[model samples]
Target: MVDVATLEKRPPSTIALLEEMERAYKDLPMEAIVKQDILRQGIHFLPEAFQVIGEYKSKDYFIFSFDHIPLADLKDGADTKAPEEIKIQGGYFDLLKTVISTRNNPHSPYKMKSVEGIPTLFLGDISIGQAEYPPIPSWYKHKTKNGKFPGEIAPVIEWGYLLYLTVFRNCQYFGKDEECAYCDINHNYRQQKGAGRPYTGVKDVEDILEVLSWVDQEDQVAKVYTITGGSVLTSLKKKNEVDFYLQYPEAIEKAFPKRWMGKLVAQAFEKEDCRKFKDAGIEIYHPNYEVWDKQLFEKICPGKASWIGWDTWIRRVVDSAEVFGPDKVIPNFVGGVELSEPWGFKTVKEAIDSTKQGLDFFMNKGIVPRFTAWCPEPYTTLGQQAGPPLVYFCELLRAWKETFEKYNLPTPPGYGEPGPGKAVFSVSAFMDVIGYSGRN
Candidate 1:
């Protein structure tokens, strides 16, 4: 419970801005607007807030350290105390059940505290909603023979709706030369190791199978499992990227064929190479194109642009559709990277317009792209700067929705559900904006 005096209510201007956006984008749900802003700006928890979080699942650092500040910067020891995701409902705006990923920023206006002994989220002083954390899965208590916890082996995210298996923790594209500018994968691995957490660089296939045995036996909610890791530009364990990544799904499907939907998040390989994953029972492929604008893509993802080249990367994304079907070939773009400072577009309109073109291109081809809200993590090259404005995200959501509806694409397979009250894809509001018949 944050001390009442220690928690400052949001300044008047902040609430006004949110209210104004809500009114302006009447067709878009107020919940989506708030969710996007919460993600963009990040959240803070008062020391007392941990009392409520202790019983729920804590942040797993599943992939990237999606925090605005590094673990060393947290004042109230929030790094280890924060929940994986928080669900908000019945706040000042009477928000529906909206799930937002936990991105620790001790200075954020959005604060979580136990107000009057009840867990609540406060947007500057106004109580927005009662807060609830995802339950720690029963399988979480189990560990592998190598003394690795299931969380470090294979963590479940999206509020326990999906299994996240990060087989290779470190990306080969290290430093400014190759690593994506907005990414902190390499830095996060170091921080976790420094924190003395069991951060494995390369998890063994046997460990993964051991974890899944618990998932298969005790878990009932996880329907999809994604096997992803940092890009293996050269070779990992004497295997090429495709061959290395293929082992997990290959093994999983071999052991429990079709027990759960298998998805792969890896580099966009040649069409023929992707067929190997499909044949191994992987149903979805996400060759993430970090950003859309050609200039920005090269600038933000130098290694990817240098190695795959933007044209071939896009081409392979399209090419993979033939192997996985158009609907299954879903590439992800960091939603607000086009609005990043320095090399990015100068204004929200320019950014959205540029991104819209990319969305239109892929949507026209029957391949849909999804995005996670960018957190300006301090360790990355583009670190600690204020991220894109909330307005940019709202406009981006609108553009994404209009373009998606224009194509009449089916609901993306692995993301749990769609629509405002029902959406569980916490990173972005793409899921929330769907079925919004009110789109103007």
Candidate 2:
């Protein structure tokens, strides 16, 4: 176990950690540096900042409760008040409209404060940049016939570039031993319900279609839709995992017929199962290989480790290349988890080398894998541990960029424009580090 006393009692300053990383990897964009740090350390909002977020696109708690603190513990009502993301620009770093997913950490050094009536993000009272909350899209105002909120049903993220459809709210991965050690999906479901939020456990296809119908008619900023949920290890409804998920794409494709790019993040299934998704009009497949190191993979993702062993999971990702086309088969890694305590690497270099091997393995196959920086939520088993160092993320981004360029692969699909300030897949800086020529 990690030294919880160290993580909770008192922690190092986020800015200090970031500055050390910035100096170490000077070549990387400062935007990415701050992005990774914000993801690692999470963000805190002042009461005034919360007042301003009231007018913006609020966080929908799409899948996991990505907050460091739970909903019940948000004394100031930050859970309901926080925006889905904050776009940073015009400050010391001169950041160019960089979008970052909001992971609420009340103790974080990076605090969102108000300045001259405008909300801004500060690092230890030293203002880093002005922050902009995503404007509430017109579609968000619409509601389903059953009176479910549109924001709860189909929320958009990455600066309104992708319509996120978390079809199933709860994962079947059960308790601590079964779920990913760092995941809080099941617990998040209970907390959201306990808080009296209208969170749906299993979203209906018609409700998804209803939301899409509104999005299809009213939204232009949304270019893609991702149908994802926590792992459906067994039958969710009556159907198996693939069958249950495939129905959404089939229904959408039939209704809209390629109106938007379709992506699916699910378990690593056999090629036959993959063909079902491809046939259903899925343009991109993300069978996320959460961690690269085998021993750590087994420890971190016990459910995946037991259900679909690491070797088989990887083989399926490779097998998917034939069905989805190598370029379209993008596997995702949880970028920072390789350095988590106890089971992970003892040093940053080892972690990066292991992750790089996974990257090289896929990129060399003309298959591009992507990653989201890991957030250590308090409810998760791994939450007791401190996340990896900021330098590890900076170096990992550099390693990813180098390997991506070495193979000269096209920018992966589903995510919007790549490069600093333009990329919208905000859970990590992987998208921000890719070549930016605008969307392919």
Candidate 3:
């Protein structure tokens, strides 16, 4: 077991730790290392920081809260003021441009401040880089005929490279026993609703279509649209999980006829169900296996374990590759959850080895597994404790890159280009580290 006291405490300095990591993981880009550290620890925006953020794309509460603290705890209007993602470049590391998603954590060593006139990311006294906020999509300025803003209906993320549509916001996983311990989906819904945000529970096809019309006509940046939401365990809108999610893609493909690459993030399903999505024009399928270890999956994601069973879920993920094409069938694991508090591995080496097993299992078959650096949101079962250390993420980036290159796989479709300064998949450094040729 990890020593809680020892694990929770930071080293003498954040910069020193980062520099040390840079030296150790020579193959990984400095941009990726810094991006992962900011993502793993989350970011704190000083009150003055928002002054520089003039009309940027704000966080849409996309899918999960993805914050270290609750919305109620936000004191500086960060809930509304914070940008959806920040692109950092040129600091102590002389980093290339790297995009990172926003996750609010007031206590994190990384802080966002407006230095002179530019939004800059600072770790201790060191200026990590100049931070650039995502631009407001033109469609964001217009509302649907029914008065819903396009952002609420279909927000663009990954620096506006993809449109995110969470059709069923609440998961059927219900409570502590069922909900993934690291996920804040259900809780985020409640908080978003409680805060009086126009957060939709079950989005209407008409509403989504209207927003897509705006995006199709007004926006040029988005190349992909993802139809995802919480798992429909019993039934949502009186339809089973696969049937419930299938409608959106069907409507999108029919209406736009493949205007943008379509991707679906939903629970694993049989080959028959996977074919329906492939028939509907979805280019990619993400049956998110939240964790790799059987025991960890059961402990961290009890609902998925109980309903689908690990063995069956694994089989479905492999089987669906035939329908979507193995390269297109991408499974996502929550990156650091293998080291999550009580149930996680005792050491980073054990955690890396366990996750790499999952990576190799799929990648060897041409199904690439990607990860979002786990954010320990306050509402989830495992949120109270600290997340995995920064070293864990650095190791994960290296492992992911090594496995990806071993198979000589193509860059996963829909997630823009890869490599430092070019990648737009901002949630983690998996994309950022690709094709990196920095110091060894």
Writing each residue's lDDT as its tens digit, candidate 1 over 76-154 gives 8688878899999998889889999999988888989897766799987898899888999999998788999988899
Question: Could you estimate the TM-score for every candidate?
Answer: 0.96, 0.94, 0.97
lDDT of 2 by residue, 282-375 (tens): 9999999999889999999998898889999999999999999999998888888888877888777788889999999999999998888898
lDDT of all the models against the reference?
A: 0.88, 0.85, 0.89
Off by over 4 Å in 1: 1-13
* Candidate 1: clashing pairs of residues: 1-48, 1-49, 9-124, 9-125, 10-124, 10-125, 91-128
Against the true structure, whose TM-score is highest? 3
lDDT for 317 (candidate 3)? 98
Error of 1 at 298 (Å): 0.9
